[model samples]
Target: MRAVETGKKPVLSAEIFVIPIEADRFLVYAPLRRAAFVGNAGAVNFLADLREGRGDSGAGHDGEMIEFLRRLEIVDAGPETPPLAVFSDDPNPVSVTLFLTTACNLRCAYCYAAAGEGAARHMPPELARRGVDFVVGNALARGEDHFEINFHGGGEPTRNWPTLTKTLAHARRLADAHELRLTAYLATNAVLSAKRLDWVVANLHGASVSCDGPPEVHDANRVTPGGKGSSASVIRTLRRFDAEDFPYGIRMTVTADAIPRLADSVEYLCANFRPGQIQAEPAYPIGRGAGAASAETAAFVAAFREAQGRARRHGRELTFSGARVGTLTNHFCAATQDLFALTPDGSVSSCYEVFEESSPRAKIFLYGASAGAGGGWRFDREKLAFLRRQSVDRRAHCAGCFARWSCGGDCYHKALTVHDDGEFAGTDRCDIIRELTRDQILARIADSGGVFWHEPPERIAAEGCACVSCGDEGRIMTGRGVKKPDRGCV
Candidate 1:
């Protein structure tokens, strides 16, 4: 904002967007201020005139429109954009994700890594020990009490049973030796044998299972080596998990063929199994699913919304990765957050999608490898810096997007594939993000008495949002008054 005098025409403070809904009605939104309202053409014109510095635009209705805009902090809001999260250059991480192997029992139609197609690469237990040692050393050096080890990779982690258990035992020994806590998580297909399932239930702190709904729906894609649907085994795993009361989340991948059954799938899962959270995503057109029909379409969005409704009735939540509306962020996932993921080859990968050397974007995401000796790792600082620079605020394509902050520029890997390493012009996922985000905004309004939706600046700041003005850390300048978040607010 330019310097304002005692009596000057006010300019638009926040980044405001006017989305046309129908013939005359418009959705006036200020993403930075977290304010949204439905308005007519007259209201839109009033805002335009104010932004263009016209004279006496808010003169009608006793200047009530001006007062209303001011209350919403869209007219004179100052510096309410959430702070862009920063990453460290030193890259000392306290968590490590081990991609156990490039082997799987199932040949999912959309297997990103094309697992089991090529010669399988199993992670040697010694490599796992080295990775764990590095993170545990970092945790101890940083005075952190706990370190995390996540089981994730291009293939089924349980396929490498020996290394998987050995890695956990090694991490436990280190945790005991250093008197630190060990947190472990697994992301698996859940097509496990009874012995392995029992071991997982007794061992891991939490797990994320991949199950795409009922038998027919799941069978369409997630099939075994013998071309049989793996849903029975998956359901058995879920039943075991429920019986043991294990902490877990269900991740469902919806292909184009399965989009119509999305709602039914969610209903089945909710009715039968108990998962702490249910995350749904359209199958990416990569690996074996490449050149296939695109699933990131309007129909998918409708199906997701319907599925969400079904889950809500069952007291469950269905989520899309890029459509988060309430959270404010600049990076979508740990891909941009320097995730310490060790591949089967002991090479470092920041993205779960780029776990294999054969990946098209492997050169871009695989940033480092082991230092060859004891416990140290090597990284390319230039690559790390490039990855760290990928924030939503830095993207030109996402500048005008209302969901930029919430979606955090969407998935970086997906962006690369969509644009072919060129400028991020956006992909079909952008529409899905916008539509879902708009729905979330409307839901917030209806939930909060159904007229307009506005979040207090201090409340946002209280949640560690560095959106203050006047260069003061203790005070947040808003249209209301100088407000401060209460101490120790979560």
Candidate 2:
């Protein structure tokens, strides 16, 4: 250890890395010593002193050790900002997954859209036109130069070919009219014929097909309404696309039934059909799978994690769509701001899981239907305001969390699902998030030659503001006596 003198104190100096295990737990590794601290005080003090330009002293000071120091300037932890809110005015809505048709060719055991009922109606051409117009107009109004539109379904979007074709044509017209750059995509079961595949290639920017794992795992849950397995057909479709070198992704919905063979599922997909991306979404207990037990859910999570770990080592990227990434550090869920889900009926929502009718937090604005004439669109500004206000309440559990701003309280749906109320705070999910975040930070530090701060690039860039969409722009306009668009009014 190199010894450095700081005002007569001999500070032991060497490069070190630290990852937070949780609010009270952390993994600290230095050339001289490796230990885990149970609280923030020691780490906080050490970080503070280092930020103030104090070099590490060879002598390890309790709660203030200069143990390992580096020549690099520490990354500053900027003020907290809410998640998802950060992109309120993102130049363009990066992606849109439209429920083109609710009709389905198969009946998955865990379908979230409840596809079998007459509720599985094809979006009328007029409604589809309105929906496309709403999204495109909203993007242009916000000054976004580029956008992506994704066509999806409650059952199968391709089932209603005529309607879908019309919608695509309408979307194209809107994009062309505005001269906005756009990418088109589709998420389907691929039960359609080769002709449909050709159409997709010609019109879509990309496609995503559903697969559980292997034939056994996939067939166990994804079966036709007549009880026939659809796995063989799905694989056939994928093989065709793979042979054509079609660009696509795989969407795997992890359920309790599929957990036991999670690794097999991932391996099967990776080995057989190389996809651009793999997304693992946990089953939500609604629609077709509402009766699924919690034990099965837990099993699925374990299996999914195991499979994901292996796949990652093999150079595959697996995204945990439903998992909370920043829970330990902050209380704001990224879905609340980062992305907005526009329902087929023109309801703008925050998270896909929460229905607009059930949760006020989900409603951003309702378009197409008349507002007060029993059918017009209505922008629920009050509901949106309530959600924004509640996001920063700072509960008891959040008082000591160091990554509070970064985590943004995990997923709001997880909170509501696990606790039965959106207003409730804290969960076991936070513990998992803290551990993961700490590990990621430590890993980055080590990769950067050790001795690193815990803050991430996004966290360092964040600046607390009253509105995520407008940020400082709103204040500037207000000072200039210009009327700004009301929050949630878009």
Candidate 3:
């Protein structure tokens, strides 16, 4: 590392990023090392204390921070450390997602797939087998011990049970042939038959069910094509998972209307379903939700805190998007990970939201296709290059942001749709990203015995806070932020 010099002043490491959480309290994080520290008002006097060669306790918490800075090499560090390397262009991806079909039983108000009305599309058995061959070949070439075959779609994967079952079997055969371990994942709306649920529990490693929340909210949005509420069916699916103690989670979509009920939604899900985890995210204004209203920022944050509290009390975890403190990521999701999502017609899309080839976004994101040549699939290297360049380090607007690596310019599809320039800048959710990330940073600090000096033992009730919709139970902020499931959120 080369020292970042400035007129003889001791240089702070460029790798060390800071965010002020409250009066006299700050969170200092090192993305490259995935480490963090907390400091108070006196911490600001680091240079002065160091200049005087004093490590006196009279300097208080600032003096303690000074010691940590020296130990962590964040201060007294002459040179700026380089950021982590960019994602690989020639990737040997170990996971492949088969968009089983673009068909759904429910017509969610904000369905990005606009499911239930799309051209009925299903993945051919040939294409599904080819997708498995492609990913398994790459994993073997890379000498990876294991790989994953995931089911997802612009609509619902369970809708195409025959394709899903056949694909999983084919993938397992490929893994066995290649001497590799294999796992399966499903992203479903969970309104399928009881027999299907039995198959899912027996065959898949884990599943993520797309349910809004309590019946009232879930019924309001996740309805059948015939305009009937499908919440009861989804509830039954959740019950099946609970009965088996299966590893599964609920993915709750928070639309503008759902914002007020955010905490209530959490409580209801936790009380009724008791899922292992609850992954909540605000609705993006894309596809069907493009014409819908958005949740207010402050309200969303407050409700998230409340919901987070409720989730913890029930021994469950609640997650938000674009905010994971422990990860030092270069990309927010799998779009840039060389991962493949095979659409119905044998085309490969980088994002789940851009499955249809006719979509304008597909020009930039649809990176591969299988045309039945040699009875298999193939990737386009040229298109792959474009996806590789979508990392956070390559973005101009994300430059110098403290949460750059943690947030990693989340969701390229959303970025492209909002900015129309394929950059994750100026999005409506930026505030939520920062706030939720800061909460994690502070929590990590507190966990390490550093003070969250400004935080109340219990969350203060913000008058008129939408979190009140869940009840007046005070909350304490921390792990409510979004984290990628072990199987991923897709």
Candidate 4:
């Protein structure tokens, strides 16, 4: 609160936060001001000396630095603005993820929900109808022209085909009545009946299949409840999807053992399935995988690079969850945006992994239910207050991170497992998020000449990424014009 210039000798800006990229270059970002500045080593030194009261403002070099920063409006102090309101008053969305049932055909080793092969619970028709009504009503109130519904859950949604179909039918009716465009998505194990497969292919806007990779790799961990390999059925499902021109992608959960085979797995998947996209995510130590350690960071990065290269050679795009370029966000996913995920029992859960009210984390994640008067759904503002507190601005540790907004301090559920408090401490994947984010940003700038998502790419230093480890490498563009380099790290 002291005057920014205590002695009026061109004091360093109170808003600027510098991240050194090299001895002569730095990435200066102001979280409060929402700005990023690239500085040369001279500017960095000048700023450091100024802050320490050793800089000579009379020097031409120092004068130029001050003038440049003054032009940026950080040199002069501004009136104190209140903390950024990252949380919205209306935490409502025009989307819903319907958990058709808590049952699955396969028991993957890393299954976060331990779905299926357990106490199976199917969502009642009444609850499903109410869930749809809740989201549709919000859409209507917001005057949205379209809304989305994703059929997904801890267990295989297709397993409860009756409830799934009924819910979709009810949602479709509501959409028609409201004259809203209904965009539906599906996430399935793909080990389903021919009728279900056909319905999904013909219905969904897009679908994500839970497939590890080749049979050997996939079956090793993703197995049937009765100790049988589920690869054959899933492979058949993928083949059917491909044959029918169904727009779908494969999602792989990378564990410690799967890390070594990642590249080979990508190659095999590309050779066999030719999926539209391959999303690979390292297993988080949650649910059934709680006891298992995640793959080594260096190992995962190396394997990801190799697999990415293999995927590129086959005209496929390899990606990881929350690793996309040109996307600047303060939350990792849509959970904070009021996207509802209805449990089989009709409990509204913010975190997909924390579905059961019996869960210890339920108090923080479970925010609503279909217990409103006349069977409508009701949201709990008190529980939602905890969720609202998780915005990026609330995490002090993430203030200096370049990926602070992109990753949003990682997953809330996972962050809770590691931290004993409400304030986000992030998960063990902090390093990975930072490195991957930096790599993606540099790769995008290299390909498009800037990071236009947050601002024009020209705002970044044009000389190229100053990271010495990555050096100057050619940025490869995918079919979608998204740039993801197969090599390099921050």
Number of the predicted model whose lDDT against the real structure is largest: 1
User: Per-residue lDDT tens digits of candidate 4, residues 1-490?
Assistant: 1223333467555455566666766666443333445667766676677667675434444454565555554555453232332544544556667778878888888888877755788887777777777778777887777676777767788888887788888888888888988877777777887887788888776677778888889888889878788888888888888898877777788898899999999999998886777778788766677789677377898899899889989998887654543344455543443546788877887666666666667777888887665866677987777676666667798876666644545666667777865556556577666666656655543454442112333533221111111100111111111122221111
Q: Which residue pairs show backbone clashes in model 1?
A: none
Count residue pairs with overlapping backbones in model 3.
3
Give model 1's TM-score versus the native structure.
Answer: 0.90
Each candidate's clash count: 0, 28, 3, 4
* Candidate 1 error regions (>4 Å): 1-11, 55-62, 458-490
Q: Which window of ten consecutive residues has the lowest lDDT sum in model 1?
A: 470-479
lDDT of 2 by residue, 176-271 (tens): 888977666676887778788788877876677778778888988888889888888889888877887887777787776566777888888888
Task: Give the number of the best model, judged by TM-score.
Answer: 1
**Greater-TM-score candidate between 3 and 4:** 3
Arrange candidates by lDDT, highest first: which order?
1, 3, 4, 2
CA displacement after TM-score superposition, residue 215 of candidate 4 (Å) = 1.3
Instruction: Give the higher-lDDT candidate: 2 or 4.
Output: 4
The alpha-carbon lDDT assigned to residue 394 of candidate 1 equals: 96
Supply candidate 1's per-residue lDDT for 360: 84
Give the TM-score (vs. native) of candidate 3.
Answer: 0.84
The Cα local distance difference test for each model comes to 0.79, 0.53, 0.68, 0.65
